[model samples]
Target: MNNEVNGDGPDSCGIRILGETRDLTVVNNRIGNAPKGQQHIGILIGEKSDRIELRENELSGNLDRKIEDRREEKLWPVQIRR
Candidate 1:
């Protein structure tokens, strides 16, 4: 596992992986502008986790509008069930 997270506060979240288990590798990090209360996820994989690999990371300006109004009122109608 390799990790490097550069920050620009506002409750920075360059990486957040939760639960379960698997092979993991996250490389080359530069995540920016991630704050808007609670869970600010530049990378948050938490649906009972699985094999994970995020490489060559360079995520910029999370475009925080209170995190898009709390992810449009809690991730509404967005279906992408693995």
Candidate 2:
């Protein structure tokens, strides 16, 4: 699935949960490789949310690399909530 996700929600992001939710879990899957020129995100949990359980998932190669970029990414693979 190129930029497509199978989550239990109406608006389909890779996985976007909101509000005073807690204890999220992402497990057992290989999420990688964006169709050239795309920022393939493996996952994202909101900052307000807490106690994320990430286990036994093969997540790799989700990045957007290009030349002439001004702001260098301080973090590799991905960046999470501030």
Candidate closest to the true structure, highest lDDT: 1
Computed on alpha carbons, the lDDT of every model, listed in order, comes to 0.47, 0.43
Taking every candidate in turn, the Cα RMSD to the unseen true structure, in Å, is 12.3, 9.2
Model 1 scores what on Cα lDDT?
Answer: 0.47
Error of 1 at 22 (Å): 9.1
> Number of clashes in model 1?
0
In candidate 2, what are the lDDT values of residues 1-82, reduced to their tens digit? 3545444332223444455445566666656544433433445554355555556665555333211112233222222222
Residue 67, model 1, lDDT: 16
Error of 1 at 17 (Å): 8.7
Q: Write the per-residue lDDT of candidate 1 for residues 2-77, one digit (tens) a residue.
A: 2344344544455665565345666777655534343345665555555566667665564242111122223322
lDDT of 2 at 36: 37
Instruction: Score every model by TM-score.
Output: 0.28, 0.49
